[model samples]
Target: MPDGVASVTLEYPKKISRGRYFKPAVFPSAFIKTVQVHDNVLSVAIPRGAPDAFPHRMVWRDAAGAVVHAFTDPAF
Candidate 1:
């Protein structure tokens, strides 16, 4: 976390299984504000620093700690 950082909200699709449940993705920092699930969409809120030219990578994992999704934001 850094000074002048702003809070960000991200949304993702919630995966459902017959005999298993998907938990909210775990973030590396404790500054995460809230995690909400509604209408099959998962919303995550956290603090983010100012944007730069370099791409920012976001990684998501399942309950087993296995990476299930990854994305790079060029604008953030």
Candidate 2:
């Protein structure tokens, strides 16, 4: 988060498949705070068998109310 953003939403993969392709799914608004009130850890369960399975996306707004997004990496 930029500026003074305190919380953000996390979108993860969801298991929903058809014949040969899985339907697109987005688990919205998994709240994550930048400034930890009690603990400084965030955890989320990733769904199996999606195109962007491991690289989950997080969304939030900056102080100017501009949307900001980030991708999670396993290497990090």
Candidate 3:
């Protein structure tokens, strides 16, 4: 990872049962300067000189603000 660049990979279920669908994950706007999604890969860029913590937990939420997915780096 380079300075000002943060990335995370998201994995979705391959099989969806009836009436099940995928919802987009929402990231914190204040911490991220830009976002790019390619397949299951999600990349977020933090502004240069931004005061933030590394090895942070990334949270994904549903429309009701409930946690749908949450993860932190395993190697961290």
Candidate 4:
């Protein structure tokens, strides 16, 4: 999260197959839901059906809808 971040988006990972030769790819999990920022602390609920093995992403955005900061849990 950043100083000007107005909202935080919780992205649940969804696995996608690439091919038999290459590993799978993970993409497009932004804006699935948003959480409120209170006193610079954000608390969001993970969906019941969200994948437990993959790490989720948090995308912080400003009021102008520009991404201010983004990070993924487990760093992978």
Estimate candidate 4's alpha-carbon lDDT, on a 0 to 1 scale. 0.65
lDDT for each residue of candidate 2 in 1-76, tens digit (9 for 90 to 100): 2444534555443332233564545444333333211232445554444444444456554545555555664332
Off by over 4 Å in 4: 15-31, 49-55, 73-76
TM-score of candidate 1 relative to the true fold: 0.30
Ranking by lDDT: 4, 2, 3, 1
If ranked by TM-score, best first, what sequence of candidates would result? 4, 3, 2, 1
Please list the residue runs of candidate 2 whose C-alpha ends up more than 4 Å from where it truly belongs after superposition: 1-3, 16-55, 72-76
State model 2's lDDT. Answer: 0.44
Q: Number of clashes in model 3? A: 0
lDDT, candidate 1, at 72 = 59
TM-score, one value per model: 0.30, 0.32, 0.32, 0.54
Q: Which candidate's lDDT is highest?
A: 4
Which pairs in model 3 have colliding backbones? none
Candidate 3, residue 46: how far the Cα is off, in Å = 0.7
Estimate, for each residue in 1-76, the C-alpha lDDT of model 3 and write its tens digit: 2222233433322222223364433333434222333444555544323323342456554434455556765432
Steric clashes per prediction = 0, 0, 0, 0
Which has the greatest TM-score? 4
Estimate, for each residue in 1-76, the C-alpha lDDT of model 1 and write its tens digit: 2222132233322221223364433335433222322433455433433221122454544444455555655432
What local lDDT does model 2 show for residue 9? 56
